[model samples]
Target: MSERVGAGKSGRKKVRDGIEGAKVVELRPKQGAASDKAEQDSEDRRFIHRDNGIWRRKGDNPPTFICGPVDVLAESRDEEGRNWGLLLAWDDRDGHRHEEAFPRALFAGDGNEIRSRLADGGLTLGAGTSAKAAFLEWLASLASEQRARSVTRIGWHAFGGQSAFVLPDETIGEAGERVVLQTTEREASLFGVSGTAEDWRREIGLMCAKNSRLVFAASCAFAAPLLGLLGEEGGGISFKGDSRVGKSTALRVAASVCGGTPQNGAGGYIRSWRSTSNGIESTALASCDALLPLDEMGQLDPREAGEIAYLLSNGQGKARSSRTGGARSVARFRILFLSTGELGLADLNREAGKATKAGQEVRFADLPADAGRGMGLFEYLHHEDTPEAFARYLRTATGQIYGAPLRIFLRRLADVMANEGEDELRGRLRDRIADLADDWLKDYPAASGQVRSVAARFAMVAVGGELATSYGLTGWADDTPSYMAGECFHAWLAERGTVGRREEEQAVQQLRDFIARNGEARFERWVDAVTAAEAQSEIPDAPPGERFRTQNRAGWKRWVREDDGKSAWRYLLTSEAMSEALSGLNQRSAKAVLVERGFLLPGKDGKIAAPISPPGHKKVRAYEVMAAILGSDEGDR
Candidate 1:
């Protein structure tokens, strides 16, 4: 069905069937990093130990050991065998030890990236050219000295098919292996265990006993890793309301489940929503295979807020060219984030004069922050005097025991995977998630497909909490996670105001609202036959107080005899006015929804506009709207 196109040095040329007249580019093995690795291996084999010390190199003015005793731990190679790096360990002036993987790409320029990172991590380099040169020279010397074997993964699990979950400084599912994060944005220092798992369980685990919001938050964090497992693209669950409703507290609690609290109440474990799209790409990668806790959605620029929502769902950042005109690797991540704010996605986009699409709303599911128990966002106070005090208590407790539960959960998960095998465990977990989703949706049989999709994410959260509980991490009752997930889901549904498609609901509501607001004021009054005859005869209006003129007519309305022999009002709208009422939506879809709901009647030809003529007016094609849409009781669809 399609012709093959070919491009050569000259220009693009259409190719018929065979390879004739098409330039064939011979593939070459990857060079640069790959060639360097082979050269390094050869140099290692021909090593002579000519330097005074292992850390000493030939480049320094006086051959010197730049830092403390150094060890070349491993040779790290990407999965393709074309790229490599070195794992180095050394001590600093404070006698503290540091270990990191130094990628060869950093040495392509002045090597400042490598030197600055070493210094930042406490491996001191001398100040002058000799000291800097000594440091760089010593680093190059490590290519020949082998300590261990290593593999590379650009971001999260299984770098180069080395199947271990790589965290900032630790590895899961693999013993005696460490994950050293050496990306441009250094985040290793932000991830660590601060307290005992026991303390965390006692301080935070019990707090979620009767609180659905807190439970949902914790579940969201745990559910992040499962996103990759379930093969589901990432999305977020937001808790939004007016300011000071314990929203930040919910985020803090969720953040603690993944890593330590922000140091001194500053950025660390909890990241703000104020980051640019580029900055967030790096941040999202840093939190890859885990939860990204974003606080205060209001901080993002309103114009970029909806764009940010789309960005998070994209799973990768913008691809930009490097200095040499080569394509740079885009930052990629798989994460489920938690967002909190005073405004929902819809409100935020509306503030920018944009109408949110149904897909975007599903991507960032918004739930009301308030639990409606008069306890702010809390369902239970846990013996605290007030919701504020309770929230404050949880926030403080999270800071104390942050970062332990997640480590425990990962360890347990690793063991389970090792025993049950990933395939078997994934199957069971998948079935469990589907079952949970079914439970969430069984009550709302008519929910939209978008609603069902979001329900699966909520179900994933429930699985995480319940799995952690089964491993004795969360100390909650068996049914707690599922119960909390359902509670929060129903709350979200209530806020959405419809079980059907969100856009459909909006379409119906928009027309109803427009007619209710402007029917009498904007529509021209039409006359009955008797009134028309009287007007034609130049007689005073037969009806005492009837008026037939409209100031700025959008359409026409007339009183007609009903089947019950009572007069009822019916409105007919012009095509232009109908378009205005259905602005910002798919006009065709809106009209279909209106027809299905009996809000708009179709002509015998099945078109949305019917051919009708009003008294004293020529016939025209117009949209006829039922008056019942303006009734006082048009509740949930």
Candidate 2:
């Protein structure tokens, strides 16, 4: 048995002639001064204390742990008796130190509770690469079960700042306050003991959902096989699922792994790397040490699809800084994890079941399930106890999983992208998404619209990017020349693609055919109502002393006040009708009305009307013409 040390004690002890301490512990190395100088010295290793639940010797107060790793064990109790578990373990760097264990929890209840707690807490789980993979595998098993259950409505209860409950109230026995159980243990125990088959099924289903989140987090952290596709050369994993499936939560966890936040807006994207408050941008995502989690990707406009694709396909690229005098070529910010909802891809051919057709097999892929899965784990790992612990974990872990000789999972993703065409790959994605949605809807009826909208947005992004690529321009930006290409594709798809070759020709032909059958009179009336209004009226010259005068009219009446005490000509002036008639008239007619009626006047030869300008120098005719004829001309002149 390992010797127990008190909290206050501080001294070294002998371990096979090695040194050990209550706070700063050490062990003597076994050695006979021998031949080979190649192997690293075993005795050089040291262990220090840490306070953040990580392994540490008692004496050390700094955040840094010793070069050698230490183990962690914790304890908690609840009404169902004292529950204990071996939560985590940290192995030595070289795998040579003596194994260490600590009491995780102590139960104050009956012997039964003590026994149960001991049983639960006895397992001394390690915290290295293989352990994380095993945890993910276990989570996947739960996900498979969750996928099978069709029931809907899952509630998430989050505790922030100060909260009364640590574990679920239902699971706790009829004990007084102060009794607490580790959330994991409580959840697992309740899952095991649920009574009826239906109850058990529900339990199983929820477990699967929760487990999937954990698995996703673990896989992303370790760069496991299931997550290999995320780091591929031109490959990305998208989180597409119905609302409340924890899609955003998963991406948040992924971002946490990269020390990032999933936020929107210029400051969030452009300045994420500089502060904790800001979120990561597509540009910053590329530099992340681990998978870059992008959330709410479907919110991007059709114009942004190309740049998004470039960031995903290429691990690195360039962006123009939003900051003034920003350089043209900046480092690319690619994403390892991309998430969205309501993405729809439809190929007329696919719906028709014609594989060989030119455009029949459009495919829409839903967000990846892992997004929710990862998000769940993030919640569990961080809980409410530690602020930004997940972020710190990600900062340290990204280098391990994403840098240097990249993980195997990333390599697999690269392989898949290299072999699959865009259509084929997208089709597979669509099918997966459909399945996920079908599952989600069983629990949430309202989720369908939200899911579909997000799905459509995602599809638009993809199609838009493809169109931009064809145009020989790269990326999404408000000012990029290729920005509108993707938008055009979206507009085309929305209209189901017109039968005519040209949009103008289509409109003209549509009008012509309709008019030919119905004659010009009906068409004329329809145009008259929809077109801008027009009218004509007479105006009086300004009073002798004033250079200019104006009149305001309402309906069909002109203001003829009794104050004049004289008869005046009633000018038949146009009101709303000006827009249509002037639009139909030539430039000269349009200008004449505004100037003669005092609505607008020329200031000399070319200048516009101004407070200090010469009487005729301000030319207000063009301004009137522009206002009259420019109300919504589908055609740009």
What are the per-residue Cα lDDT tens digits for candidate 2 across 1-637? 2344642333332331232333432221122232233222321223333232223222233222212232322222222333332222344334433322112322222223423332354433335554334333321211000000010001111122111211211211112222222322221211111122232112211222223342333233223121222222323434444555554444433332222212221112112112221123433332332343445544544333433344444545444565586675443332334444433222222233222111111122232342222442233443334414543443333222221111222332334434564345546645543543344234445433423433333333333223222322222232221222222223333343322222222222222232233322221111111111221112232112213323332111112222334212121213332332233224354445445534343556553322221133342122221111222211111
- Model 1 residue pairs with clashes: 73-148, 153-159
Model 1: per-residue Cα lDDT over 130-176, one tens digit each? 65675665555555334233433322365333345676677777634
- Maximum-TM-score candidate: 1
Candidate 1 residue 221 Cα shift, in angstroms, is 2.0
**Over 4 Å off, model 1:** 1-69, 129-141, 144-156, 159-162, 175-179, 265-267, 324-327, 513-580, 611-621, 630-637
TM-score of each: 0.80, 0.24
List per-prediction Cα lDDT, in the order shown.
Answer: 0.72, 0.29
Candidate 2 wrongly placed segments (more than 4 Å): 1-35, 40-277, 282-331, 335-413, 416-624, 630-637
